[model samples]
Target: MDAFNLAKQRYADLGVDVEKSLQTLAATPVSLQCWQGDDVGGFENAGGALTGGIAATGNYPGKARGPAELRADLDLALSLIPGSHRVNVHASYAELGGQKVDRDAYTIEHFAGWVDWAKQRGLGLDFNPTCFSHPLSADGFTLSHHDEAVRKFWIRHGIACRKIAGEMGRRLGKTVITNFWMPDGFKDTPVNRRAYRERMEQSLDEIFAVAIDQQCNRDALESKLFGVGFESCTIGSHEFYMGYTMKNKKVLCLDAGHFHPTETLADKISSVLQFLPEILLHVSRGVRWDSDHVVALDDQTRALMEEIVRGDYLSRVHIGMDFFDASINRIMAWVIGARNTQKALLLALIEPRDRLRKLEAEGDYSTRLALLEEAKSLPFGAIWDEFCRRNNTPVGVAWIPTVKDYEKKVLSARK
Candidate 1:
């Protein structure tokens, strides 16, 4: 069949109305993690650690020069990707001697400025704390560390930035979202490991306290219109995993690829969801034991994808493509990654659940297991085609399509 007619027939078979599916897809917002001047040669001068012994210099090409240039680039990128507004800013500096030392000031002011700028453009900000600057945080930012002064400094800086973000939201009529990921683990036996976890929580408490204060301040100013949204992620092995702390917070931003090299992705997702039903997912692809390549999903990663679809957390979910690619055009990488992730998520939502049910009824784990395997290996193009085709109707596009569509086609159809 021709591509268009094949698409049409697929829609008919899935009992989906085309127009409604498009609307549904359009409604799903795809957020991105972008550097300030990733395009227009601006990333060249930002000044940071070199990767793989290569000096980090002006690698990106575009019109951006400084902060304003970077901000403009982000604005343009968001414009091209519809329903995408959130940008994760990577704040880093090598030294406090010159312009690099003043990065704290620049970062604070630039982010606050961007928050204002994003308001004008109707976008959101996702601020990630300092991680790239290894010299400053060589010992990591855990509470158990002996660097009391440095730890205090980190807390003060975080509070200051968040306060500025909160104030900007009040003035600009937008929301400021924050995500915290602490590098606080050890490879060897720690002298005082328990002390470290406690300290980390203590630091987090201080940060959370500031957030609560900022939320109140924002709430009081605008009648609770522009409140702060707090999220945190950690490597899966943290002493007190993110889900444990997220109970008091709004949501945990689960990094699907951050679990240990040998850990099962699906088990991690199931565990986190069981603990915290509402989550903000950070999607990236990598082997269980290798570096983050930022490639699309493989078989192992799909296990988590399946749980995300079958669970009840899709609506509250916000998707972000988190990866590093210095050689490729940064904006294009983001755009392509976002598009591919959209396809993956939609496929997970549409996979036939009746097959899963039959496998359960017959105590046949193999078919259900194979279904997840198949779901993961399905090509991105095929997934998007199927999603668009199956979601072609208003009824097919109803509330929480995954759950509802599963009920209509699989559950009701069986009856």
Candidate 2:
């Protein structure tokens, strides 16, 4: 407490309100990805390999096999994470009865169990339309496929997901962000990229034809540079989605791992906010490509959050986790990625943005640079520790042993 108090005074001298930063961070919610627990394997009972750009590379034992087990594991992860939070669910993760239910035909009844589970924990929910890992999408063309039947199949699935998301949000009294990302492209350079993008645009329009209230469900469109097999041409490229999102006034999801290796989203947030009302961010780490590695407190992430806070666009941005690392303890992976995300946001929030901006506006570049470098040495760890302590979550390494104990008792016993 004494250390935190001293750190608070130091930041206060720079015109940064430490209490306001903590309050704002506590109110912010970071959405957790559910696929990290079971390596993108959902409860659909669909015995098929993960196709599309998705692949969780690890044979870690004690993976959750069903909804009950997955929820139990999530419960433990959320307990360790500080601040308000929500869970992001892919359509494939729906908890349905033993009977087979196709994706296009799915309804909210299939996910009522998930809503009830979230309600019990006072956690909000976000959703995704799973457009991969099914026979319909096995050809690596869905929504953008030339075949009308194939395109319509994925189109219906997307529409159904929007309806489900609306209901989930209505029940929870929070807007559920339904994001659409498809693995539709060609392995080799296609002669007709226009046709595929045209089909995709049409499909998206039809899926969003039904007007769900923005308060009930918000929509996001995600784009990718390339994927595993479709390295030559990705139909839904960044330019395509950016143009579409601007025209339609929908949220554009800028995933950290979805761009070129050298590019960072910190440079794009303010650019998009100029036209789009709001945007969604999928925080992930990419190794050369979109490998979906666990997120860390790296420079790219810190810069991204700094842009959001410095631009005062935090309220206009919805942040969600998109990485899935199956190589380590899944529960621990969740805690590490989520906590680091919170840490990055806190680091950005604690910056003396007003003073920095004043210096920059006054043409005092040298002093701005000096202050920025000096601020990097500030006691951010103390503020973070105090945040965790106030949230009643385990501070630092204290939560790690709980995960190990859960693995030994609950996870190991799984056959």
Candidate 3:
């Protein structure tokens, strides 16, 4: 309490309203991707290779065995993280009760239990079509496959996913963001990459021909620069999606780790928003390439959130997280990444923007730089602690013991 008092006064001196920052930060919902809990291994089948150039290294024990365990793990992770949030679910995680149903045939019945679970917890849900890690994607292509039959199969899967997402939104009274990402690229330089892009454009057109309830769901297509086997080319490149999204007026999904490590999503957010009404933002960290490491409170995340808040684009930017780290405790990874994301947003919301902007507009770069650096050294930890208390979440390391206790009681027995 004393620390918070001091921090509040310190920020108030800079014309920063700490209370409004806390409120804005609290209202921001970061969707926790389901893949993190299961290491990109959904509940569709017992075991299969990660075929989409997706890799989750490390063999940490106590991985979720099924939906029940995954849900329990998510429940525990949410309790530790402050703020209301949403869950991002992939098509592969459908609960079909041991019945074999192809991806093209999935229905809302398979995910009805998830909706019920989310309703009970007051959590919103997001959807994604798993266009990788299946036999159809074994050739490193799905929607962009050369074979007509293969393209149709994946196209059907996309259509089904959109409908299911719409139902989830209607039932939950929240708009579900159904994002599409595929591993459609070549390991080696191909004779013709344009042919595949043409095929993919046709396939996407067919899949999106039938519209779902717009009020219930929003469609987003993601792009990738390159992957392990896809070193030379990626069909759904940023340029491709940008053209398609701009033409169709659909939400473009931008994954932080999906681009060249040099390119940052922070730069693309404002530019894309000028043409599109909104965007679906996926948060992740890449060590060198698109490694999908756990997200940290680094400059990338801080700058991305800062851009959104600075532009007043929070309502237009839908934020979600993507990364799977099997190395550490799965629950701990989620807690760390989610909490860091929220903390970054808090930093952004509490920024002394009015003063900084005034200085920038007047070309007072010297004072602007000084204030920016000084803002960093402010008592942010105290403000974060106070925000955690306001949300009734455990403040600081107090939640660490709870994770340890859960690991011992629940995770240790999973083996």
lDDT of 3 at 142: 92
Give lDDT: candidate 2, residue 59.
Answer: 80
For residues 138-257, could you state the per-residue lDDT of candidate 3 as single tens digits? 889898888989999999999999999999999999999999988898888988988999999999999889889899998999998898899999999999999999999899999999
lDDT of 1 by residue, 1-415 (tens): 2554555455445443444444555666666766423421223244344321112233533423455545644554454443445665544411222334333343345455555666677665555554323444554443334688766766765565566556555655545455555554444445665666667667656755754344322211000001011013222233264534455544566565555556565665566556654556667665433233454745544555557666645664555656655455454455556555665555555565556667778998987788656644433354355444453411212323443343344333321
Candidates in order have lDDT scores of: 0.49, 0.93, 0.92
RMSD of every candidate to native, in Å, equals 12.2, 0.9, 0.9
**Clashing residue pair totals per candidate (backbone < 3 A):** 16, 0, 0
The true-structure Cα RMSD of candidate 3 reads 0.9
Least accurate stretch of 10 residues (summed lDDT) in model 1?
219-228
Model 2: per-residue Cα lDDT over 1-415, one tens digit each: 9999999999999999999999999999999999999999998854458999778898878889888899999999999999999999999998768877899999998999889999998999999999999988998999999899998899899989999999999999989999999999889889999989999999999998988988989999999999999999999999999999998888999999999998868999999999999999999999888988888999988998999999999999999999988789999999999999999999999999999999999999999999999999999889999999999999879999999999999989976
Worst 10 residues of 2 by lDDT: 45-54
